[model samples]
Target: MAEEMKRMIALGFEGSANKIGVGVVTLDGTILSNPRHTYITPPGQGFLPRETAQHHLQHVLPLVKEALKTARVTPDDLDCLCYTKGPGMGAPLQVAAIVVRVLSQLWKKPIVAVNHCVAHIEMGRIVTGAIDPVVLYVSGGNTQVIAYSEGKYRIFGETIDIAVGNCLDRFARVLTLSNDPSPGYNIEQVAKKGEKFIDLPYVVKGMDVSFSGILSFIEATAEEKLKNNECTPADLCYSLQETLFAMLVEITERAMAHCDKRDVLIVGGVGCNEQLQEMMRIMCSERGGNLYATDDRYCIDNGAMIAYTGLLAFAHGTTTPLEESIFTQRFRTDEVHAIWREKEATEKKAN
Candidate 1:
């Protein structure tokens, strides 16, 4: 009874890729502190696993301490520890799991393993107050259109090859753009000046999308076109964004229609783009639906989402054993059994 009366808190660690984030969250979805550091490579380059893992190790502990300090909570105040378990870079995922394992042993708190995709959706729902929304998750490593069904956030559609963010990042590199904040962000900023839209390859097969062909085509011809003054960087950026976001909106709307849902939730880092959000909003509005999104804080990979999802799972009797606390790089979103949403799914289906 006394333990039940106490406010349950979770300390979460997310080092699934270039970003290393630590956050303190309560069971009621209140975020006390979320601090993170991103490992940015030089322009025209992408971060590799070894370097990214080292970066996570260098900053994770300090960030954890800072999160605790800012949240005004100690290890004793936390009820559990959580971390991103899969669907990320292997070495980077291991960094968070290793840290959480040590913390669990020291603090004598239970551990909860969270799926990264599920965390994104859960965080968007909590922040935007969106319920039963068809989600479009676009990030550096993943791109998927998802909806809840049969107690899982099922993937209705996804990228067949490289993700949309990767395509945008590669295009930014071709333009020799800065990666200070993000490649996608730089592309968005430059795209604002674009007037004429040069036609690019638009590939959409059913509910899935493919960007490798477009990226290869752009990589081969962008510089030549720029040198010949055939197309400006802004025009290229604008065309690429329009083509890709249209494919995304198409598939997301398809999923929404298939699920009979009226709300759209955009998650992951690439969802932070205003252009993408606007396109999705227009599509949702045409369908008499609402579009939901968040800023960089919750949209990018962060520990707050992991903490909140793990807290929800923990409250619903989910726990991770020490031996089973392992990292998987290819875990799919549908692989997770969302015990917390079982009742909701059943009721929704019944209705």
Candidate 2:
């Protein structure tokens, strides 16, 4: 009764990339508020870490005020403060870390250093109610096939070079596509008008996928092909999306089979694509499994994911000391021991 009655709330800040977000969440899976602003670059350009950090510096405080107002919670109401610790741009990642540190000092609250990738997985799990599903985490910075094993989110497969979303973003830049909302989002929209299926490159080395080769080929030939009317921009977008999504699906399926898991959970920024979701759904259905997914609100980088995941850690008696709450740019998802998870698969069975 006491456990059920206890309510722990966390205020989280996320500025690991172009987006700066603030969110408030409770241990009971209640999201009081999740507000964010993205630092959108002009068409055909990507956001640099330094400029992105400057943007975050300009907007973090306002977003925090907005989040608190939206949640109707004061600093005293929060049980803990949370912020993403790593696996993101160094400059942008530090903005959130510093903000959380200041807040921790002011409010006298404990801090929880969250792994960004794990936050995405935990957010997907809570939103979709997926239990023990193989995770396909696709984003601008990461691409991985993950599963739970022995108290950890194990990486079964991953990208060898550029991420899947990075491929799409660069392709969009090559075509001079708009980045108003996002390059990947625009690519998905343009791909809908694509009729021809232009083959580029298919690279799958074991469970790892490589997008750099495919992207480089596209970059070299997209202009020439478009100039010669060999393939429309839509066709190129379509073909690129198809190849990337297919590679992801392939690795995810292999992980599922290897893990003997029947459910698949898609997470991260690129996971918001409906076409990718449908393809994964079909694959899951064919294998008599389930596909768990969330929309853009949860899939994209946001503070609620950090808050909720942090609350989970806090509830598990996990806290980050002030001196140890520093950020990094290369924290792997598999490095976090998911102490909140009660049950884990002991080992992978032989295939």
Candidate 3:
């Protein structure tokens, strides 16, 4: 193992979206320090790409310094530098990549380009110690049910349109809720006070789910409620959460069933939802399985996950050449080859 040879330290930069995160981790999956800064737009205002990019640019260096300080490590101590490469907003992703390039040149260290979604899955697996569990990855820009097969993280299901977190954020904007901490957290709080279950469209096509219809219906419902005072915002939030989370759970369960996997792992920004976790726990209980999840610290886009995943890739001889260092906005989860999981892949093939 890399940890046995020497202490392998990796510095990770993650600014794929509105949040700018930096962290340091070792090869053994020990997170030394994880720090992040988020750009919170005003109510009813969504974060623009350019603005989010600027936010990352403004805070990336400071966050990186803070991470290094907290980890009690200097630049020379890092064995490698890692950054989020794709499956995120282009401008924000560029901010992370630019930082990575500058750091690699300054510190004279190798660099690893991490897939944002795969990083989340790897972090979930590391923290939960979940061996070969079906992953439910949900965030503002993505929703996918992933599992390992044939040396790759295969996507069994995904969002056809808007993601589950995007649906909730747009609805929060319609309601003019505070975006201080997070829109989804505010929605969850309001949802707890709700008693009525307003009917909302639930779209699940085979193993995939769509949130555009549900988002539109909720937005219209919020407007109608404003005009007629027919239902409380709490009730709308409650119903929305119920409908969307149920759709996610349904698709995730289907993936688990098809894979015949007993363990269910939830990762990403939306995975921090208590209601979603509770529902997943109930589902797993029924199947006599287990549910694994992390808190917002790891679940949300952070550098720790990136660092851990990068360590794994580095151990497997994966490195991004300086000339080829680039970011993509639409990198699929299945496109990544899980070289570190070759053992698991071979075992699955044998079985």
Per-residue lDDT of 67-88 in model 2, one digit per residue for the tens?
9999999999999999999889
Residues 190-262, candidate 1: write the lDDT tens digits: 9999888987889999999999999988777786888899988998888889999999999999888889998
All candidates: TM-score: 0.96, 0.96, 0.97
Q: Which residue pairs come into collision in candidate 2? A: none
Worst 10 residues of 3 by lDDT: 1-10
In candidate 2, position 17 carries an lDDT of: 89
Give model 1's TM-score versus the native structure.
0.96
Q: Candidate 2 at residue 248, lDDT? A: 92
Candidate 3 lDDT over residue span 1-351, tens digit each: 534634888999998899999999998889999999999999988999999999999999889889999999999999899999998899999999998999899889999999999999999998999998999999999999999987789999999898999999999999899997999999999999999999988799999999998887788878887589788999999999999999988998999899999889999999999999999999998999999999998999899999989988997789999988899998888898889899556767899
lDDT of 3: 0.92
Candidate 1 lDDT (Cα, 0 to 1): 0.92
- Provide the clash count, candidate 1: 0
Candidate-wise lDDT, in order: 0.92, 0.92, 0.92
What is candidate 2's TM-score against the reference? 0.96
